[model samples]
Target: MTFQDYFPIWDKLDPRQQNQITSRLVFRTVQKGAVLHSGSLDCTGLLLVKTGQLRAYILSDEGREITIYRLFDRDLCLFSAACILRSIQFEVTIEAEKETALWIIPVEAYQSVMAESAPVANYTSELMASRFSEVMWLMEQIMWKSLDKRLAAFLLEETAIEGTRQLKLTHETIANHLGSHREVMTRMLRYFQSEGMVKLSRGMVEILDAAKLEGLRDGL
Candidate 1:
């Protein structure tokens, strides 16, 4: 689908604004594990996913990483083009988790339209608010939630996202997502295994008891 199909507010812009934006929409395909945007200085523009998955994450100065959000098919990522907003200080790294088809709208073109069109401006504000809400939610999870609960939630989420109970992910990979050490993740998984919540083999983790996992996630 084109940008017109992805963005419902396309027709709300005037002909001039539409022409300007249409001229700058660039379609690109990226391989899995490709870093689409890196660092705070890279103004990579706005990314709209056409297919597959994209992960937006923050990397600590010490090289630890935590996923702030993930974009699946049909999701629009405002963080990638956050350079347009003067108030945003942190930059997020965006990577393709699966082979992806995407379209990028240049910041300058989008900003120009947003300047002249109320609909565009309002839509941009709505998108920013939604993304920030997720950031705040993630902050709360990290500050008050335990690793076991967070890990359980993550496994459950991964199971749903990947559509399987068998997760082909390493402890180190899980650690990176939670911003924890691999040793800690290993210990937690071992504990879960002993409790008969999961079965771990090499790089895979198979959920043995979904009920216990859900109950743990809920603090029950």
Candidate 2:
């Protein structure tokens, strides 16, 4: 897909402004396991994911990595939007989950584009608002739901997103996303497996009965 396909704001720009902005766009390929940015690094412009997945995480006091968010293809990594606006340091580490392609624009370039077009600024603001709402919803889910309910909800959501009952997530990855211990997640998965709600295969989890999983959510 072209840049305009990923960023609809580009389509709203006039020819002159679009040409100027597109000319400055740079593409970078990140290998699997590469660190896009560390916690101590300075925050710059946003990193738009064109393909593959990325994880934003932080190191806890006990030296455990706690995942904050996951970015799939077409997601933008803006972990430190405030820092980027204020020209400060970032506090999150962004890592590539697979070989990824990203578009990197300098802060000045982003500012220039925003300044040139009111629609671009409005689009960005909407993006930030959506991200904020997602984070808030995730926080509420963690605080209000039990482990089983959370797992069930996650499975259902993933199924809808993947358009299939089979999911390609590991236990450790699920634990990170749920903000729980791996041992807890393993036990939860075992419970689901024994109840015939899910099946565990080689590094993958498949929902055997989505209706039963949905039933568990009502009990939450």
Best by lDDT: 1
lDDT of 1 by residue, 1-220 (tens): 5678887698898788889988888999999999998866788999999999999899888889998989988788877886886677777899999999999999999888888899988888898899889999999999999989999999999999999999999999899888888999999999999999999999999999999999999999
Q: Candidate 2's residue-wise lDDT over 35-110, tens digit each?
A: 8777655554578889987887766676566666778877876663335545544367788888999887666667
lDDT of each: 0.90, 0.78
Q: How far is candidate 2 from the true structure (C-alpha RMSD, Å)?
A: 2.8
Which ten-residue region of model 1 has the weakest summed lDDT?
82-91
Q: Model 1 reaches what TM-score against the true structure?
A: 0.96
Model 1 segments more than 4 A misplaced: none
My TM-score estimates for the predictions, one after another, are: 0.96, 0.82
What is the clash tally of candidate 2?
Answer: 0
